[model samples]
Target: MTATGDADLSVVAAALGDRGRARMVLAVTDGRALPASTLAGEAGVSAATASAHLRRLVDAGVLRAEQHGRFRYFRLAGPEVADLVEALGRVSPPQPVRSLKEGTRAHALRLARACYDHVAGRLGVALTDALLDAGHLVGGDGADSGRRDGDRLPGLDVVDYSLSADGRTVLTGLDVAVPDAAPVRCCVDWTEQRHHVAGPLGRALLTTMTDRGWVRPARRSRALTVTDEGRTALVDALGLVWPPPHGPDRVPGERTALSRA
Candidate 1:
């Protein structure tokens, strides 16, 4: 293995150190390529300044730029890059907002959004909880601290996660293949400050949802809007119901599961 001391960590840190460049990176963290002009606007910079920043990122191997005639589109170099951005959010303080719109956007992000390839935020935590409640996935600070020896430990944050026999059946029934490696893992959600599921199983579940049309990307945003069919399917499969019916500004049936924080 290569020595950690020899790694180019500083290069990546430097690339992200700039506010303008960082905003540009966040704009494309959604696993999509965007034109330089779009990224420029995101950074609140001029075309020439954005070009310089993007070129630096490209050189750092943090982003990839593709040539399409007169326009160049940029995207994160790979999944690792996306993961880095997501992890950064976990450590960074929340952005300050001066208006209700900004606050609302932040709230929407906290409601449901993707952490790279897997679900995250309240929605992500809810899905994981549902899987446990349904006995499809078994894990947590359950009896026995999740040990095969059956030692019970209460109040533990999370020990681990594994698919039960029923989980395997249900997943296979949905035509989603269980991952062969690292099938179960936990990700600390930045917004909720709690653990949500990740790893192979999480990816498969998200993919199946997208394929089945249960969720769709929101316009110009990372938030995912659960469809009507999705709401029904979730209620059926996991007994998870959303929407508390508050009144105006309420999206009917828009439920996000919240557990013991």
Candidate 2:
């Protein structure tokens, strides 16, 4: 890399190096546009301190600020920023859980959370697994054998996953309207170290779930909750196992039979 490129990379890294700034970044990783006050609370910093951190992040191109009526809101620059955050999480050691609340939040995030515009965490991985098992998607096993035209997303080396014809029909039945000719891509989940559906089709699935009241975002966090109705609907439609296959008090790979159509 050129010296200029190295300098640019270091600038962004420095912006995210502070604990308070990093907390603010993670708080908005779900693509929510939050104001300085909200971010101050999330970062556990005073309003003035948070403002300074936010300004630095914006100047570093790590975040973008927008005017919403009377206040300015901040969000990650784009999907690329989200990818960087997940990549960092992949290599960073886990933080110690110091309190009951912190432990709960950590557990919840690891179980089910949004990775930017799509689902992630263990639940996300399991959802992808169910889709693959049901023949709704192909190539999620990290193999490139099924590569076809338009399988790869530009600027991202996302695996060659694609939605199958049956997958289209299944999504339609579930009222999920994927964008026309949307490419399917796999996002490497930081927590699970497994791939989950991403790209345009992945966003559509998360949107449909939220719209149908199947999943709801927790306040101030990316963690998602699957409602009782969602549990039933997901199981009946996609055969996704509830409570995730692995987590606190759960066994790994202990999944029941899928109710395939």
Write one digit per residue (lDDT tens) for candidate 2, span 1-261: 645433458899899999999999999999999999999999999999998999999999999999999999999999999999988987799988999999999999988898889998878877887788787888645322324547563223555677888999989988898667746778667777666777888899999999999899998798999888888888888878765665232333345655323
In angstroms, give how far residue 144 of model 1 lies from its true place: 18
Top candidate on TM-score is: 2
Quick one: how many clashes does candidate 1 have? 4
List residue ranges in candidate 2 displaced over 4 A: 1-7, 142-158, 247-261
Q: What is the TM-score of candidate 1?
A: 0.78
**Model 2, residue 75: displacement in angstroms?**
0.8
TM-score (C-alpha, index-matched) for candidate 2: 0.87
Q: What is the C-alpha lDDT of each candidate?
A: 0.71, 0.82
The positional error of residue 89 in candidate 2, measured at the CA in angstroms, is 0.6
In model 1, which runs have C-alpha deviations exceeding 4 angstroms? 1-5, 141-159, 241-261
Q: Write the per-residue lDDT of candidate 1 for residues 1-261, one digit (tens) a residue.
A: 855667779999999999999988877766678899989988999999999999999999999999999989998898788768867886798778989987887777777777667787677766766666677777652121223434543222345678888878887887777886634776656665555667777788788888898878766666777788877776676655364111222232244463222
